[model samples]
Target chain A: EADIYQTPRYLVIGTGKKITLECSQTMGHDKMYWYQQDPGMELHLIHYSYGVNSTEKGDLSSESTVSRIRTEHFPLTLESARPSHTSQYLCASSSSDRNTEAFFGQGTRLTVV
Target chain B: AQSVSQHNHHVILSEAASLELGCNYSYGGTVNLFWYVQYPGQHLQLLLKYFSGDPLVKGIKGFEAEFIKSKFSFNLRKPSVQWSDTAEYFCAVDIMNRDDKIIFGKGTRLHILP
Candidate 1:
C-alpha cells in the first residue's frame, strides 16, 4: 500500500484566496515531491525536497511554495489563488536507495473560481 | 530537458485482443525507463521499469515492454488484454541515478470492450 496521503481530495476556492495543500507520508522517506497535472494531461513537477529544510524548484515554474520541516510533511501553499491554479496536485515520496520506486498519494483536485 | 512522447492519445480494443502502446523519449545521456498505469479513480501505480539489463522486460498483469536503444523507444505490450485493463498508461524517463526527476508523457488512454 502507498504510505503517502494528500488531504482535501477536492477543494474549491475563490480567486485571491490563500490556500495550502497538505501532504504527509509514513514511509520515512527522504525525498518528497509535488506535481501538478490537469485532466488527462502530463504531470509537471513543481516542487521537491531532498531532505528536511531543503526545498528546490522543479523544472516547471510554479506559483506554489512548499516547506519541509519534518520528513513526513511537505505542504504546498499558494499566496493567492487563481483560475489557472486549478489542477490535480500529487504528492510522492521515495527512499534514499537508487532505482527505488516512488509512492504516490491519491491526489488533491483544486478548483479556483 | 528530456521529454517523453506517447504516440497514441486514445486506443480502443476488444477483450483478448493484442495491445501495444508506443513510447519514445529524447535524452542523449543514459536514462531509465518506466511504465505506470492509472485505473479509473485510482492513483498512478508502477507497472514496470527498465533500469539496466536485457532489452525485454516483463511487468505485472501480463504486461511487457521492449527497450530499443536505437529508436529510444520503450513500448508496452500485452498479448491479451482484459476488460480490467481499461485505464491510462504513462511512459516516464529519468536520468540514471536521478530518481528525483522523471519526465512523463501525456499518457495513452486504453478502452477495452467487453
Candidate 2:
C-alpha cells in the first residue's frame, strides 16, 4: 500500500464554512497533487506542488488554494465551502524519477449542505 | 493542448470474456503511459505503466497494456477477465519535460457479470 494519507475520509459541512483538507506522504516525494472527482466522472487536477514553498494551479480552475510548507505535507484550503464544492478530493505523490508513478491516497469525500 | 481519450465510456462483459479498452493521446512526444483502476469505493491504483523498452508491459492482476508509439495509443487488454475486474479504468499520459503532470482520459467503467 502507498504511504500517503488524507484526513477526514468523509466530511459534511454547511455552505460558507471554511475548511482545510490535509494530505501527507511518508515517501519523501518531490511532487504532490490534488485532484477533484465526482461520482462516475473523470478526475480534474486542481492544484500541485513541486516541493516545499512551490505551488501551482492545475489545468482546471478551482476556488481552493493549496500550500506546500514541507515536503511531506501539502494541504488544500477553501475560503468558503459551497454546495457546488461537493466532490471527492484525492491526494497523490510522485518522485522526480523518469519512470516514477504517482501513489494515491484514500480520497476524502466532501458533502456540502 | 495535450489530452487523452478513452473510446468506451462503459462496457459490460461476462466472466472469462476477453477485454480490450482503447486509449489515445494527442501529444506527439516522449510520454510515460499509465493505466489506473478504481474499484467501487476504493482509491485509484496503478494497474500498469509503460515508460520504455518492450512495447508490451504487464501489471498486477493479469492486466497488460501495449504501447503503439506510431498510433499514439496505449490500450489495456486482458485475455480472461473476472468479476473482480469490474471497475473504472483511466488512461493517463505524462509528456516528458511537461512539468511531469499526468493528463487523464475520461474513464471507462467496466462491469463484469459473474
Candidate 3:
C-alpha cells in the first residue's frame, strides 16, 4: 500500500477561514508535491518540496503556502480561504531516482462557502 | 516548456469493448511516459510507464501502452474492457535531465456500461 496520507477527506468552510491541509508520508521520500484539481478538470501543480527547508512554487499559481520542516510531513496552509480555493488537493511523494513513479494520497476535497 | 495532451475528454464504451486513449507530449529530448488511473473516490494509481527499451509496456489490470518516440505519442490500449475499468485516465510526461516535476495531461474520463 502507498504510505502517503492526507487528512480531512472532505471539508466545507466559509470564506475567509484559515485552513491547513495535512500530508504525511512514511516512505522517507525526499521529494513531495501538491496538486489542485477541479472536478473533471486537469490537475495543476501548486507546490513542491525537495527536502527539509526546501520548497518551490509550481507551474500553477496558488495562494496557499507549504512547509517542509520534517521529512515525513508537508502541509499546505491557506491563510484565508475563498470560494475560488475550493477544489480537490492531492499530495504525492516519489523517490529521488529518475523514472520512479509517485505515490498519491486520498486527496482532500475542499469546498469554501 | 513541456506539456502533455490527452485527446479524449470523455469516452463511453460497453463491456468487452476494445479501448484506446490518445496521448501526446511536447518534448524533444529523452522522456519518461506514464499513465495513471483514478477510480471514483479513489486516489491516482500508476497504470503503466515506459522508460526505455521495449516500445510496448504492459501494466496492471490488463492494460498496455505503446511508446512511439518519433510521433511523440504514448497511447493506452486495452483489448477488452470491463465495467470496473470505468475511471479517469491521465497521461503524464517527465522530461529527463530537466526537472523532477511530472507534467500531466487534462485527463480522459472513461465510462464503461455493463
TM-score to true structure, per model: 0.95, 0.98, 0.98
Task: Say which candidate scores most in TM-score.
Answer: 2
For candidate 2, the TM-score of chain A alone relative to the native chain A: 0.99
Query: Could you tell me the TM-score of candidate 3?
Result: 0.98
Deviation of model 2 at B107, angstroms? 0.6
Q: Residues A42-90, candidate 1, lDDT per residue (tens digit)?
A: 8888998889998999878999999999999999999999999999999
Please list the residue runs of candidate 1 whose C-alpha ends up more than 4 Å from where it truly belongs after superposition.
B97-100
**Clashing pairs in model 1, backbone N/Cα/C closer than 3 A:** none
Candidate 2: deviation at residue A102, Å? Answer: 0.2
Over the stretch A1-113, how does candidate 2's per-residue lDDT look in tens digits? 99999998999999999999999999999999999999888889899888999998988999999999999999999999999999999999999888989999999999999
DockQ metric, candidate 1: 0.74
What shift in Å separates residue A40 of candidate 2 from its native position after superposition?
Answer: 0.3
Regions more than 4 Å wrong, model 2: none
Clashes of 2: 0
Q: Whole-model Cα lDDT per candidate? A: 0.91, 0.94, 0.95
- Model 1 TM-score is 0.95
